[model samples]
Target chain A: MEPSDEALCQRVAKRDVAAFELLVERYQGRAYRLAWSIVRDPEDARDLSQEAFIRLHESAGSFGGRSKFSTWFYRIVVNLCLDHKRKRRWWKPWAGDAADDQGESFLERQPAPVTDPVDELGREQTMKDLWAAVDRLAPRQRAAVVLQVQEELATYEIAEVLKCSEATVRVHLHRAMNALKKTMKNMEKR
Target chain B: MAKHPETDLVPYLRGELPPAERERVARHLDECPDCRQDTDQLRELLGELSRSIAEPPAVNWARYRAELREKLEARRGRRAWWWQPVPLALATSLAGVLLFVAVWGVGRQVPTAGDPVAFEEAAIGRNLGLLEQYQVVERLDLLEEDLDFMSDLDGLAAGRPG
Candidate 1:
């Protein structure tokens, strides 16, 4: 039988890479997809999800098991996605830097040369408009909506992930759907 | 008592509603076009989102797993000999003590601004090898502060020219 997430986490606390790999295998899909849904960039999502695993490895020892392992893990992934989005939104291209594994500094990685967003729109209008509308929502609202529509998490589970009340999750989803509807309307006008 | 049952449309579309709440929202939707529009619009967005984001593209899980293992190993292996926690902690404590002693030593040498005598005494204590000459230096300093004695020296030098 596969070890429970809590049991795997306990082993991970002892620096067991195998245990961590199990945890990663179990959650990587949700982590990557949740990140992709929020950030909308494939590489960024991959990086963010991997970073979440790295973080889980580091902080595994500190896990008190107060919440379920998935809940705790999702919190880490969601926070990283939100932080990455905020950093990308405020960051300017070709200014400042963060270093990579090889100690090479890279300036902000944004405005990622869409070459022609219109070309993208022509290729997949439905997917493009849906993505654009989701992106238009506020971060938490976007997160709430994505968790609902894509992750298919119930409102209570989303509340656990978001660390908020179920009511607040509902409010966020309501606002996000409204905003998305408005965005779709505006896109049609254009 | 959720006054805004339209908020329930999201869960309704997701089929998360229980049978009773589902029936109630369904009945309400039948009566209200606006709520029906809400359900339809969100349903369309959810359909697209589910088709795309829900079904994430195939990731190279093998490569991803290998890279993550590499990173985990690197992170766990980061401490060189000098970076060992025990030695680093010991070295940090030693440096902290040395720094405190250096600061306190400096504080002792620096007399408060209002106390010239303490400053002189400290200077004298530091150069005890020059004890015999310190009195002479003090007298010379006093003489330099004497304007009349300086003017006499200036007059003498003016007369002598050399």
Candidate 2:
């Protein structure tokens, strides 16, 4: 049987590097995608997600097992991404790192010439416009939305990640969905 | 139809509502065209968002894992060395000594609120008060001179008793 997340955390607390590597392998994709959803930039997402794991390794002893490990880890990842969003202008990806390779925002990246099935769906432009609008949303709204829909976290779990009440999480999701609808409709008209 | 049951949509879609509540929403949806349209829209929005965000970027996971290992190793090297309580304790002791010296030095420059300096100032003020009483002796001397002059004047007025 796979070791429980808490058991792995205990191992990590005991300085078991292999256990930590397992934890990283388990959550790295989720962490990276969550970060990417928020920052919408690949390299920043990678860096921020990596930083979360690094912090987890450093602070593993503090995990008291009161909450789910994934929940605890989610908080770190979201907080880091939200912090990065607040400090820098998402508009200018290359403002600080002039050497940044994937310096474009999600909308600005050049899509492949050939179409994937997802692109073949009537949603290529719709998804683009929606994400562009997501980029425009207030940070809290975007975080709330991503946490709810993409991460599939419940309202209270999202609230835990956001450090707010469940009602506030619901409000954010409602607003994000409404805004995304309006944005997509406007894009369809264009 | 006019009053769409929009409030129930999110929880209903997420299957959060209780069975009774779910049944109620179902009944409402059965009769409500506006709510059905709204639910349809909300579901589509959810689908699009889910699909978009689920799409992965072309990241090399193997490289990511390797780089993280390299960093963690370097970090572990630094942390393991610095985390020895002996060094931390030594640094803390050094800092405490420096702080004590600083505080002690400052205390010497400025006396405590009501200690040595205040008592000395009070003593000096008392001595100065004693010095001011010296002028009272001079006033007594002036009175004696005045009495002598009066006595002489009275003798003269007595038409030179000689």
Candidate 3:
């Protein structure tokens, strides 16, 4: 039988390399995907995910079993990604406009006229628009949506990861959905 | 019509609502076309979000592990180097020396040989006992003079001064 994540985390606290490796192997895919979902950049996701594991290794001993290891670890990754977004947001005004303009033009150039609602459901342009809108959401709101939709975390678990109340998590989801819905309506009009 | 549970729809779609609330929302959805459409739209959007978000590209597990191991080893090596007996001793000694210098430097008021004020202060400190004795001796001399004057007066009274 495989060792549980909690069990492995305890061994990792003791600097058990094998246990740490096992934990990393168990979580790497999920961590990378989760980071990628937030950052939307593969290289940054890989680095951020790796940095998350490094932090885990360093701070494993501080894990007092108050929360599940997964929740604690997710908090670390989410915080790093959010911090990265904030730092990027500072420099974005100078370096971001050209790339964003190009991306917008490219997206606008794509032909996405669908006669049937069912047909629109699977269209590539719709997916792109949906994600583009998701990317544009406030970092916390976007994180909430990703946690709920992609990672399928429960509201309480998301609250734990986001270090916010469950009601706040619900609000984030509500606001994010409203924005995405508005985006969908706009896309439909377009 | 009941209030639209706009806030609860996402949680409802995610099935995170408590059973009673879930049932209530379900019944409401049955009754309200507007809410039902909203729920359906949210559900579709969530579904599309899950389906549309691309998977992270496959990483080489062996390489990933190797790179992480290298980083870990380098970190450990740096820590070990700092803790090695020679370096640790040297660092401790250096820190001790710095602390000693800092304390001594702050507290040091050693008189320089050329500072006249310091020299004078030191000289006065050394003669302090002598100075006190001199004061006592001077008072004793006055007392002796007074004694002589009295003795002269007594001699005059005794007719010895003539």
Q: Please report the candidate that would top TM-score against the real structure.
A: 3
lDDT tens string, model 1, B1-162? 225486788877777788999999988888888787778888886776677653556799989899888877787677556588888999999999999999989887677879999988887778988757879988887988796677878988889541
Listed per prediction, chain B TM-scores read 0.47, 0.51, 0.54
Worst 10 residues of 2 chain B by lDDT: B1-10
TM-score for all models, in order of appearance? 0.66, 0.69, 0.74
lDDT of 1 by residue, A20-114 (tens): 88899999888998888777778888989999999988788888887888878888999999888668656743322122111101111122223
Clashing pairs in 3: none
Poorest lDDT segment (10 consecutive residues) of candidate 1 chain B: B48-57
Instruction: List the candidate 1 regions with Cα displacement exceeding 4 Å.
Output: A93-124, A183-190, B1-3, B6-8, B12-33, B43-48, B52-57, B79-83, B106-162
**Largest DockQ belongs to which candidate?**
3
Tens-digit per-residue lDDT, A49-136, candidate 3: 8889989998999888888889989999999999888788677866432233233333444445454434755477678767877776
- Note the DockQ of each predicted structure: 0.30, 0.28, 0.58
- Deviation in angstroms for B15 in model 3? 2.3
Of the two candidates 2 and 3, the one with more favorable lDDT, higher being better, is 3
Instruction: List per-candidate RMSD values in Å.
Output: 13.2, 10.7, 6.8
Name the fnat for model 3: 0.78
Q: Give the range where candidate 3 chain A is weakest over 10 consecutive residues by summed lDDT.
A: A97-106
